[model samples]
Target: MSLREIKPGNHGYLYVNSHPTGCRAVVDRMWQQAPEPAGDRPGPVALVIGSSAGYGLAATLVGLRAHRMRGLGIAFESAPTERRTAGAGWYRTARTAELAAEAGSDFTFINGDAFSDSVKEEALDRLAAGFGKVDVLVYSIAAPRRKDPLTGEIHRSAIRPLGTDYRAKTLVFKEGVPQIGELHLPVADEAEREATVQVLGGADWQLWIDALESRGLLADGFRTVALSYVGSDITSPIYRAGTIGAAKQDLEDTARAINTRLKGTGDAYTVVAGAAVTQASTAIPSIALYISMLHRIAGDAWQGTSDQAVALWDQLVGNAELELDDEGRIRLDGWEMDADLQAAVRTAWDRIDTDTLAASADTEWFREQVGQIYGWDVPGVDYEAAVETTVPWPGSPSTDA
Candidate 1:
């Protein structure tokens, strides 16, 4: 089916199946824009912690296609047992492994929890036996909750505003309406907040590094990166500047600590990626509305999660040293959160007096970009052709099932 026939709910599946082709295009564009990888040393081995979807998988594909790196992905989600299946991150890794096979590069997928000691040990063992050491380690896990393996206590994360009553205007994507609402920040007692900090913050990141280093699985002159985002002040109380914001602050600090640990070898950095609409981003209370409006105002042809991932890969993975401000965090999201940009968007939003918010907010470029992310607006591809095909999961346990 053409991308148009696939409704909003199933769009993510379609994107994953088509991502290999999309990633190829991204790689071609990156090579055209930037210089090639520095050395001919056997293509670097990379391990992507959250390699199922979003930026994690994008970084994996970018390393493969643009930098010619061999990769292994570790995802907590279940793998697909059937062809043309739509499990999260399934199609991405499948497609990536398929292409890697075609190019004679190694690719592996491990379905397990990234925080567990056993899983980390397995990953390290595999890397040591196969590739000796990994040159790149990308931590991109974004789970809503995590169960403490030892205590059996489940910790859930909240995206609501914390400690302050904040009023905000947001968009309803389904109804295509703009409405104002007050965000009731959660009143988490001290323990809950501390738990939130422990679960969502950077402790797991540090743990992963410790596990790898203890096992001596890091390559010399290795690079490691983690992804973070700081959204607009409008959503700050709920996002970066709020409870999750506190988590991110811890994450940034962890990045610095990790960088210190990796100092003699090479570099460890955190990428404060720009905000685009992702499954994780959309679920936040006021963010969907913000993204919808931000999409309209920025007018730089806003793309979906896949496109954002591709752009991130091009800028951060394919090229080293992001455009960082004096604060040391990369500033891709800065433009989106720019004071003037947010102010103008807010002004335009206030003027949206009627329910024709979709029409009022719609821009030709934004629509076109969203279309492209779903494989709609791209040129030279026959939309009518039967492009639907099974996702080939390389090295799956049994093809029969």
Candidate 2:
């Protein structure tokens, strides 16, 4: 199928071939922009759980390219089977291997669910045999559903509010300009809230680390962090104060527990990121509105996955020291909440309607970023040409001519 011709599913999720050039653009920029570290001593061996796209992809890129480190990227990405190709994550993983090879870096991509105990064991086995122990384990897995490897229970995340329904100005992506519309959200019940926490919270992160530690896969001086987010007051009803927020609170609690449990080895952190349109963010209620308003206020400063990854990774490695909040969490949401910027965005947000939305928020940029998540809307890519779906995985036989 032609890349541009591929349509999104009913839920607005599109599956496309990941753009190699666009992926390279992100890495190249990160390589050039990040400060050159002193000494020939490079960073540590890392393992990124959700290591195909978004922050996980960015973290793997930094480890292999910028940090001059070996890494194992484990992601539950499907291979290109039959006529249809796998989603963009698979392509992104393939491209990461290519980039790593060119840079003479040791990198591996494992295709399996990070939430599964069997998959975790496989990763552990690989890490034990190949790298001994990882210095940093970045748990960046974001999934809609998680089947508890032990209990055989399935958990799904919810993004609705707790008490009442939420109605807000939201963006509807279309042919050209995004149409602004009012979206009504439902309220999540107790069961839904618990389910979201189980899937999206830090329990899995803690479990992964515990498994690693029990098997002695985590090296001394090893650190771990699972990404979290806390947006401004505007979207709290659906995000920070919703079912998802409850999960994050659990995640943050797990971070503290890890800190206490693994005193000598290292500490676990819950790094709170900003409100940006992501695969995960799509599930959040009114994300379109929140992200649009944020972009309006913060503009270029709204931290995307790449720069945010760099910042978090820098903190993880102790290269950069940030003043963490009271809960000992790293806050890297960018300038969206800045007083002056907040002041500037209110005028537009207050008067925002279908007509004024185009004028208020950078909907073009918003859509571009959202599309880039699925390997669409990227510049300098020939979408009309056929994209080779299968690519070499690590040291596997070449799928190319």
| Per-residue lDDT of model 2, residues 1-401, tens digit only | 22233333333433344454454444455455444445557558888889876677777877776676776889887666545556667767766787778877777878888888888888888888887878988888788889988799999887788899888777776655477778787888999999999998887898888898888877888888788888767778888888888988999999989988998668788878766677777656567766777787675676766677778777877779964888888888756667777666666667888887767777777767767776666777666655555555556676655
- Estimate, for each residue in 133-213, the C-alpha lDDT of model 1 and write its tens digit: 778888888888776655777787766456765466654332432344444555545565666676778888888888878
Candidate 1 TM-score to native: 0.78
Question: Which residues of candidate 2, in runs, are more than 4 Å off?
Answer: 1-38, 174-177, 399-401
Model 1 lDDT, residue 394, Cα: 54
Relative to the true structure, how large is the alpha-carbon lDDT of every model? 0.63, 0.74
Best by TM-score: 2
Error of 2 at 32 (Å): 5.6
Q: What is the TM-score of each candidate against the true structure?
A: 0.78, 0.91
Model 2 pairs in collision = none
Please give the lDDT score at residue 371 for candidate 1.
Answer: 44
Q: What's the residue-level lDDT of 364 in candidate 2?
A: 72
RMSD (Cα, Å) for all candidates, in order, is 5.0, 2.8
Best by lDDT: 2
